[model samples]
Target: MGDNVVVSNMELERLLSMKGGKGEASYANNSQAQAIHAKSMLHLLKEALDGVELHAPNIPFVVVDLGCSCGTNTINVVDVMVEHIIKRYEALGCNPPEFSAFFTDLPSNDFNTLFQLLPPMANYGNSMEECLAANNHRCYFAAGVPGSFYRRLFPARSVDIFHSAFSLHWLSQVPESVEDKRSDAYNKGRVFTHGASEITTNAYKKQFQRDLAGFLNSRSIEMKSKGTMFLVCLGRTSVDPTDQGGAGLLFGTHFQDAWDDLVQEGLISNEKRDDFNIPVYAPSLQDFKEVVEADGSFSINKLEVFKGGSPLVVNQPDDASEVGRALANSCRSVAGVLVDAHIGDKLSEELFLRVEKRAANQGKELLEKLQFFHIVASLSFVL
Candidate 1:
């Protein structure tokens, strides 16, 4: 990925820091909601563990939450899993088996935030020191592993359960065609229909296929036979090429419009636009399944979809006007890069206001254009 498009580790930390202001708060809020979806995956893991225990009663169990940002969600999942395991063991009239966990994410993610959260979490029942000393029936350890999930980040057959939430949909990098050329297709005030086509849609699907294969292949090597993986990601259901032009389309139509507006206002120069494209991609359900099943690495155990609602309506009271404002603000952040690229630093304020005004005019009912999907899928395979 190009340095400009890739959010460096330090930048990610800064964005998550309390000092980063409302942006950080927005990110945290969104992440927390996304984390709730992780609970759906946990349900599948419990089923897989049940199946495995029927064969290997004494085998150790390890769960890795890939892309475990700041470890808040990881800690939550661990607490629930531990409780469930204890109940199961009690029914069996035996002690709980040993368990370990690994929290993995980009090196730039806030591991310090996770560490700080852990001491408090460990002290919630018994102090962390006490838990470690009393480790007999079950042992829990959490550590940050810094690396991209697209590459092998764990040893082969080292993990029993693997889970990732709202993270894998991001492409390794922006599409080369978009990155290599400065096309008018990226201009602002352009309608979504102007450039919507099956060709572009197919290209995105192929890119997702490649990334998903890489992700699953690495996991296949690291997961033991009969191991399970629960992946929940942002996805779309519509196959109409035009519907693909929604604001949710990453680094494509909506983003291009932002850049175009900035350039027209003389805020950013075309030279900078040459190097700009967001390094995120959202895939359709069919494309997602193709990548997961193609490698023969996993068997689909369950699949379900839920509305992502509006990125803007989060945590707000159910007021139509306020919801509209929230959605507009969220859209602006995504479109801001494009606007900044064209308008330069000078007119950014003006461009932002204009974008906000445009969203308000469009209103909440129209904000359904920003709706996305939360896809939950479970897979199991023999290594």
Candidate 2:
């Protein structure tokens, strides 16, 4: 996956690829849980905003969505945030500051789709008029800032509130040490570190620590004193989620096994299979605590782990095949391009079909057995 990591058509950074287009092909349908979770996490934002001291009345109040894919969940997240802050201002009987919401993601992100969902006249994008109109806030702004969040994307102390959901599991880049030919942690069979040899798992851990250290350090420079960041993503509720059945971590394991089967049948090469690894990691609770404690950048105000339930869609069939197909579509919608980009699209269709078949075979029991655990945390920037 060395050459495969770089897509032939571009040099742009690609994270989890969101489904493209305006209709069924898009991610709008599959992200219902994200929207629900976005709404549910409002209290964290509110509690954090309660601590923000706006020294200058004319300065715009700022909120940024770190990985706002296609803006479906972004709208609700920003909407709820504005409502929360406005209520705080009202509670204090003070004039509210102007609002500015920044929606950021990788360069390859479908920002056009995200822009369509926003107010049209913003040119690049700056306002969600009708939503903010209801509140007493006079001016509301929204914009797409395309870049990797692991680096500096804004000025020092320029940010007030930061929010990210269902993102951050992605590593800035795949760990280079795992691919070493002479290394014991080569990850010869599977594409992830989740139940691999101790060397492999620890190699992945070191990458997360390095990447997360940079993430925290960069944010520390840009965040105002006590400015809070709320992050939620799939993570291990235990020290290791490898033993956790029905956890989202298994999807890669299942897919990698299928890839191996395909390799065995001479459909795909084992070298390509071994070379390709999913560039994501679900940090354990202790992993998160260790990073937060060592970084000296932020204090954890809250951290909670809970299982997320999949909402049944309207007009969707209640059978195993359809259920599995939808799940596959959702998977494809999110990570298909990333997979194809890493290995080329020649085998992608058949690969995901195999995934769909396996999922469908599980039937309604899949629904019963499906368990997605999320870690939501509130962090206050250390001054």
Candidate 3:
């Protein structure tokens, strides 16, 4: 286990409370596509499980969905997993073994939103009930165990399969070197660039390596031999050390742009920039492979990228003109801590307005240029 970074529960609660309802709305609105992604993950997990069964036939299975945000999407994943389990059991003509399902995320995730969405087994119709009756394997849901993936959060040899989607790219902490250095070279009047000094970039990468190793080591302890883990996350395609379009470039530059804009407009003080780093880290494929292979716990079974297009714009009515307001709102929750702590309430709004105006003037076409790689990788380890 590692010492988890301490974030005040009260502060996190305030941030979540501010965006809880809106985040729930976003999840509800995006349920369909999210379901599709979850099902795809299930398909990949099942394939891995099939290979595992060739060696260990009688062991029960435990599947965990990490960073399962509040909504039907979580249930959709459970549904798909249960359905697959039933199909597999029937084909084998063997009684299904006990199973445990875990849902995990940041302590600040909208768990209340999740609780409200739990499925009523009685209402799940006949087929699911028959499967449940035959198997006698109960479903369990839990939350708020671990924050950083850098630490062990479960018992050793306990998990059989782990699944996380749209998560795990979050860095444990901000790099110390970039803590307070604000320059137009990095941040320009609310329009930020991801250009970090070489030192800062290296520092961030080292932090990522440390966190990645810890994540895999912890998972190795809990995962049964030959257990499977599937992770789907946002990553960058470019591997170029000099390219500003890399994963580091995207975050550092964008943050700088936003910070600079805010500073020029007197929305934020330069001193606050040190406290304003986004908590997320988008790793490129090469970096991801380097970290995982170094851990020596699991081997890759499959890796692929999806959603090569720009940042997904939700709730925008116009197709050609992106909804800058909606985009800002969507970004606010994930990166809300930055605005609340640094720019404060009044200036954050002013800064967003300026950015939105610029986005509109640019015809929001540039927004369409922003691409994200949805990398899906499956891994399995020998017990």
What is the C-alpha lDDT profile of model 2 across 1-383, one tens digit per residue? 22335432133265455766665536766777567656666776677667666545467789898989885788777777766776677676676667788998888788888877774332213333344553433245788898888899999999988888877877776666677768897878776666777777777777777877888898999988778888887676666534333334345544666677678877767777777666667777777778889998898888877566553232444587887677677666777767677666767777777777887777676666566667788898878
The 10-residue segment of model 2 with minimum total lDDT is 120-129
Every model: Cα RMSD to truth:
5.8, 3.9, 5.8
Q: What would the per-residue lDDT of candidate 1 be over residues 248-331, giving only the tens digit for each residue?
A: 443343345555676676655565554444444456677777777788988888776666554554443445555444544554
Candidate 1 is scored at a TM of 0.74
Worst 10 residues of 1 by lDDT: 13-22
Tell me the TM-score of model 3: 0.78
Residue-wise C-alpha lDDT for candidate 3, range 1-383, written one tens digit per residue: 11122233235423432234434224444344445555555666677656554223355566787767666666666556645665677677665554557777666666776766675433233444464664423343333343545577788988777777766766666544445345322321222224545455555567667877888888999888777877887666655422334333334443356666765666456545544555455666777788788888788888766554444445453543455554444455455544554455566566555545544554455455555566678898765
Error of 1 at 313 (Å): 3.7
Show where candidate 3 strays beyond 4 Å: 1-19, 23-45, 52-60, 122-146, 180-193, 241-256, 314-322
Clashing pairs in 2: 126-141, 126-142
Residue 90 deviation, candidate 3, in Å? Answer: 1.6
**lDDT (Cα atoms) of all candidates against the true structure:** 0.57, 0.70, 0.57
Candidate 3 deviates by what RMSD? 5.8
- Residue 77's C-alpha lDDT in candidate 2? 76
RMSD of 2: 3.9
